[model samples]
Target: AAMDIRTLTDDLSVTGQITQDQLAQIAAQGFRAIICNRPDGEEPGQPSFAQIEEAARAAGIAARYLPVTGADLTDDKAAAFAGLLNTLPGPVLAYCRSGMRSATLSSLAQANQDHPAA
Candidate 1:
């Protein structure tokens, strides 16, 4: 399974689900952090959040889990996503089951912000 990273901003990119082996490639890409938007057990045969997080930590990449079902993207969740984007060290990579959740959250968080406007 190839992890295709799609850049949404200089500091952020979104991608479909990735495997533990891909964490090293992400780190090699110079991404300082990873933001996961998929929930554990949401899909069958998916890696648990703990597995991914541990792999990220071992590779020296910061990791965050902000699961959103995409059925409803509440302001609070979007706000939390924004906060992570603001605080996480730059060049972050976000991923979800299909990448839509990650992309949606990134856009919502960027709304009315100066980061992408500049």
Candidate 2:
């Protein structure tokens, strides 16, 4: 299936689950990094993080697996996601099962960036 990507910012985007075959297309779109926000085995036939990471490498895109569930979207995880955005090459594509979790995490991270703890 084609990627249903939604832009969150110039440097970041969120998408639904991607297949290994989609890596090259993602790369061709000039995305320099990928963040997998979906946990492995969330559903039957979903690709594993290891598999996605390997394919991402082959596509010349850096990949990080930062799996997050609804309950796991804590301040710490948002901080981690913010850290990845600070360090990873862009534009970065983050994905979850339906992209909502990834979008939420990105929003949290961006909010933290805008207003850091004093």
Candidate 3:
């Protein structure tokens, strides 16, 4: 279930997609949390957020479904994502269909209240 994960910063990384079993591997790799940017039923074989959440819970890693498709990406979602990161354990991994949405969101999260549109 391992995939080539892209580390974006000290505490953030983006991944294409992950399987249920990959949650354990993510924990083993020192990622304390997961943000699923991919929506449920996006693809025929893609695992749902509920399934991944169950695996993450069993692995002792927190997981949240913050799904965002390309068209749905917004500064508000990014800010919310940042808030989630601030509250969750460090070294979080955010995964989307191609990791692009997650990566973009991570960058947007770096913006602040003064420039939420950034």
Candidate 4:
């Protein structure tokens, strides 16, 4: 399936299977930041975090790697994601293997931020 890109909120853009070349394309298309949600070493042949980071930097975009595996989306991950979103410039593009995880993480982060502690 083609990669999906969606705006979960005003500041976050989520996507799937973003290549180094595609990162360049996204930069050209005016995206200012890129956040990678897939963990390194999960699957053989997946693009390295360094490769994407280098590409994003060369393209004049800020890059951040949060790297949440399928099993790692706990409260800690959600909190960290929220922290990153609060600091990173938008419109930020976050990606995972299928973008589902990226979108889920972003939504969870937003929810966590919206709710107050008891």
**RMSD for each model, in Å, please?**
3.1, 0.7, 1.9, 1.5
Give stretches of model 2 more than 4 Å off: none
The regions of model 1 sitting more than 4 angstroms off are 112-118
Tens-digit per-residue lDDT, 1-118, candidate 3 = 4587999989999998899988878889999999999999999999999999999999999999998989988888888899888998889999998899999998888856546443
* Candidate 4 lDDT, 1-118, residue by residue in tens: 4447787777888888777878778887678898899988777888988999999899998988898887888778888888888788788889988888888887787777789456
Write the candidate numbers in order of decreasing lDDT. 2, 3, 1, 4
Instruction: Give residue 29's lDDT in candidate 3 (0 to 100).
Output: 94
* Candidate 3: Cα lDDT at 19: 92
Which ten contiguous residues of candidate 1 have the minimum total lDDT? 109-118
- The TM-score of candidate 4 is 0.91
Off by over 4 Å in 4: none
Candidate number with greatest lDDT = 2
- CA lDDT, every prediction? 0.89, 0.94, 0.89, 0.83
Per-residue lDDT value at 107 in model 2: 86
Q: Residue by residue across 6-112, what tens digits does model 2's lDDT show?
A: 99999999999999999999999999999999999999999999999999999999999999989999878999999999999999999999999999998888788
